[model samples]
Target: MVEAAAPAASVVETVAETEPPATASAPAVVASPAPSAPAPVARPAAVEKPVKPKPEARLYRSRTLGQWIKRVVLLAVGAIAAAAILILAARGVTTLPGVPEFLERYPGEYHLPATAEPGFPWWAQWTHFLNFFLIVLIIRSGYQVRTQQKPPAFWTPKRGGKKISINLWLHQSLDILWLANGLIFVVLLFASGHWMRIVPTSWEVFPNALSALLQYMTLDWPVENGWVNYNSLQQLMYFLVVFIAAPLAAITGVRMSEFWPKNAKTLNRIYPVEAARALHFPTMLFFVLFILIHVFLVFSTGALRNLNHMFGGTDVVNWVGFWLFAAAIAITAAAWYAARPIVLAPIAKLFGQVSSR
Candidate 1:
């Protein structure tokens, strides 16, 4: 065994050279698995960022213009009533203080004082022409008879005065025309049945009148169908204006002629000439009163509509009649101015000094 060992020195060195190299020089560092982070707690799906709700769009509404127009019409109706009160108040303010004594002293001769000027315009002249013609014819003829100390023979304005011939002819012509016109007009209204519309259908006119009176007196209006409306009272007023007042004017007008006024005369059969003339001035006064009232009511009811009818002729419907009153007013005013006697008595008395010789 000793001999074999001794022989291996070089060979042993060769064997050692064939072995693999050692890796002890590099050290390996092991890190503990990072402490497992606490498992995330599910927070109800992150609350979805509360998606703020979008606001909703708003809607608005408006009224139609036609509805607004109805309100205007209502206001217009109210305005008419308001005007009546104002007129009555105005008349009271101006006339109350001065008229009482005048009325008491001269009931027969009393009339509304004349305006400062005479004729208003052409319209007035045409309206009042008939009245002017009739009155003048009667007055002129009467004056002629008085002057000559005999009864008037003519039924028209005599051929006398500053323009007697012209006045006489015109007066005579209008009389015939007026008669025919009146007959036709009256028959037309009555025949068409429009006149019946104004008549009260209810027998409660008196009770209705009472209630209306109370409301008027109390300054408290009661609205049923509408407020402060006219009942029988209004109907009567309408009827009187269309029937009584207008008819009286025509009837008495015819009586101005001797052909009409004489007893047993054709015209006299309808109305006595003397009686007609007697009522003439008074009837005029009544007409004036009516005119004042009618105007006031029209203004009160609805000034615009009333004026439209009075000045422009009936409503667009043209059912209502046109007002020819302006024509009459003009003639009356012009004649009144021309006929107005100068109050020269005072000056005459002062200078009547017998002209101082």
Candidate 2:
């Protein structure tokens, strides 16, 4: 037993000798740091694009030439339709009760007074021509004076009371001529016993005038015998134009003119310039209408004979009066064209000092 114990103890002693010895404190431990997170990337900030501004809208829409043409066509068609309707309506009116009888009884005219003279005199023809020339110039200058924004030339009188526009000067000058011509025409008319033809003698004129109007409207015009005696409608129109309209025009014109007495406060109050202005334009419009109607009637009803009565002082239908009328129209047109500042300034300088300012 001893031998076996001795062998086991020797083996333990050898293993104990081969084994490493432990110290009083264990060796200090060394730990490695953990891996850090990756640095954040810095990208360029997003760039903003500029926005475009919108355009402003127009006030009035532009129209094509075609649109204007369409409008003009519509107006012309409308006028034609209206005329057709009026003619149809007038024809229909003739069929009404008592209308036909009334038209037949009157026959559009009444007998002239015993003192009335037949046919136009040579003086009447001359006066008519003078009136036409003066009136044309008056209307042209008057319109220019009214509508001109800037005067081309101004006139200062030799005595120099006030500065007046060239157009106004022309208008005033023409007015004087017209007044003189009118006065002469009036004197001649009475002296020649022609006033009895135009002045109404009886109340039969009213019915005759109505009958004449109806006849004209129905396109069945009455017989025109202006040389022997004017129709009642014609007589009334002539009287109104010569008496009522002429006097009214003259009074209103005088009130508006520089010749009026500015110091006469009472007269000015009684006949205000405003009233004169109001009446003057309407009177001009009336004259325009009368002239247009008269010219149209002259051309439509016996053009040659009427032209001869006025222009040739005879009732013969010939080209002599027509040629003379054409020449008169040419002369009038030349006068109109020559009424500009360029031509008028020279004439104006003869009487007054002309200036642009």
Candidate 3:
């Protein structure tokens, strides 16, 4: 029994020695991974820039008084320089090429006799004043109408259909009145035998006008005898104003108005709106120039005498004419100041439909 127990114990010990430890024998279990930080988020690309918008176009540009004054000064200077150059060239300046021989011709060769006559009559004086008043109104309204991009007030005739601006309505209304006045004046002038003063009987007036122009440029104005006879230049200018420029202005103005034939496409195509516009604007400028020169001469030559002829209807130099002239001028100035849109709108409403745009 001892030997059998010893053999059994030896067998057990042998088996234990052959087998590995329980920890070594067990399968290896992977350790649970440690929790990791959230993956870094990708940043967005740089924001794109916005595009800029384009600027709008302008219809009219505003200018300062200084700029206008500068422009006038420059224009005057240019005119004077050009006149000087022309005169020098005409006088056979060796440096000047292509100078016309006619430029060198003096007006004395074509002068006409001054017909002795009484100064301005009462009708003449009254018509002159009327013309002056109408012209002033016409010019003011015309400028306003021309420059306006947006009409503050629009006008339509009682008949309706076509619409016109208040400024233009005023201009056209004044124009109609002026035309009537001009026609009456013309008729009266012819009946009174005063048409001879303005109308040229012969072609000789051309050279005389040139001479007068030369005299004016040289600061040697022609002898003042408007009471008796106007210089050839004066007569020509008056003729042009009365016959050419005035009619041109009227015609061009009408062509632009509603009165013109709209459906006359072929006629319109031939006599384009652009042509009428070109003629009209320049005609207005011509009238402006004539007024400026006329006023300057009236004041500078003999204020009292000139005033007497136009206002008092006499050749006699007196303060009575001057006083009347001053009063007329004052009235004109007041009218000019009062010619605002507020005032003009009411006047326009009487003739047509007036409404704020």
Winning model by TM-score: 2
Off by over 4 Å in 3: 1-61, 64-117
Assess each prediction's global lDDT (C-alpha) against the native.
0.47, 0.88, 0.82
> What is the C-alpha lDDT profile of model 1 across 1-357, one tens digit per residue?
888887598788887889855569866567788877888877665455677888654422244566666777889888878867765654464355754454334222111123212112234223334544454444443343334432212222233222222223334445566555545545654555433434445455545555443444333432321111234455566567556765776666656643342446665565555787787557656756765765676545555544444344433323232344445456656654553113222232341221111
RMSD of 1: 28.4
What is the Å distance of residue 196 in model 1 from its true position? Answer: 2.7
Candidate 3 clashes between residue pairs 3 or more apart in a chain or in different chains: none
Q: By descending lDDT, how would the candidates be arranged?
A: 2, 3, 1
Q: Is candidate 2 or candidate 3 better by lDDT?
A: 2
Q: CA shift at 264, candidate 1, in angstroms?
A: 4.3
Model 2 residue runs over 4 Å out of place are 1-78
Decoy 3 TM-score against native:
0.73
Task: Work out the TM-score per prediction.
Answer: 0.37, 0.79, 0.73
lDDT of 3 at 85: 80
